[model samples]
Target: MANPHSDHPAHLQHHFVSSEQQFDAAKMGMWLFLVTEILLFSGMFVAYIVYRTWHPEVFAKSAELLNPFLGGLNTIVLLASSFTVALGIHYAQKDNKKGLVINLVLTFLFALTFLVVKYFEYTAKFEHGVFPGAAFDPHGVSHGVDYATYNIPYARQFFSIYFVMTGIHGFHVLVGMGLFTWITIRALKGEFSSAYYTPVENCGLYWHLVDIIWIFLFPLLYLI
Candidate 1:
């Protein structure tokens, strides 16, 4: 019997039975990648739980030094970026190239804003002598804030977890920005449309996953 999808678009691989099949396959692959990401972070979360359990007081006190205001601002920025990406996908589906491009640019800008805020937060920590591992030393005054007061037993554990988690999250944000830039270039060249937007859709899914990770990290590292 002749294949029903033999006339599928160029973007649809010849091996795929249909466009829907290809799309589903791509989505499934993306979900698998997201699952691996979760598993990777799960190890850090377990370490955090164990250390926090052993030194709840230290964890609480150390967390106090972190700026919840900046964390909250980053959370808002990420969420807004997620919304913009969703809007970009919607515009792509509607064949509105201008809307899609605008939303993607907005999303990229939001991601950049989040990273900039994180830079200052990290610098503030470093200036206060809040280093992780053996270099862990909170002494002297920096940025008009004294770190010696935060020198509690096992406080290093808390800062270690903070740096590792936030560092990984920041790396993911950088990657997302690069992905958005590539997509934005493609978007400018009229590469995506209602008929084919797999790249944009996949990128959106990845960005959402990154944002979700931050949602979890914020409360665990900043609030709690």
Candidate 2:
């Protein structure tokens, strides 16, 4: 009798004993990456806590300048994108290439929409002189709102953390978009199937993480 493992897929590496092993290894690696990501974000979260503790009023007042409506809309967009990525992985596991492709495309579009909204938000902030650090100067009527009122002490800290955290999250969104684009093209070319869909699964995991980060961000930076 021939070895059943002899017909392993082309993408399988020689080091992996079986496709199951390869998938497990990929998942382990992703988890490790996620751990590092969590640690990285944890430092920023700690900073936010420390500053907010010291200057709660400033932080609260500064947060009012942020448009919660836009933030909520972006939150919805990211949540929807997370759902589409999950659906993509489901279709990939079911060997439904067309469904996978469609979901991936939708996920990318949702991500793009999020960034577009963010672009407008950032532009409004810049126009209002809501910059970080020593350049922090809110003086002028932009968006028909006077930003000079927001020029409270330590308010820069809040905006700085807001920008850094959300900026990093947005960067992840862009990265997820690239990953989905690659996976979508592969799906269109019949690269994924029930037998070999590790890429889709891994990318879905990444997309979900990005969405999760934004979920945390929306409330911390907008609602709370």
TM-score between model 1 and native: 0.94
Local accuracy of candidate 1 as per-residue lDDT tens digits, 1-224: 49765576768888888878888899889999999999998899999999989998889889888899999999999999999999999999999999999999999999999999999998888887898888888888756767898988899989999999999999999999999999999999998999889889999999999999999999988898
State which candidate has the highest lDDT: 1
RMSD of each: 2.6, 2.2
Q: Please give the distance, in angstroms, between residue 194's alpha carbon in candidate 1 and its true position after superposition.
A: 1.4
Q: Write the per-residue lDDT of candidate 2 for residues 22-88, one digit (tens) a residue.
A: 9999999998998888888889899999998999889888888999999999999999999998898
Give lDDT: candidate 1, residue 121. Answer: 93
Model 2, position 134, has a per-residue lDDT of 77
The whole-model C-alpha lDDT of candidate 1 against the native structure comes to 0.92
**Cα error of candidate 1 at position 106, Å:** 0.8
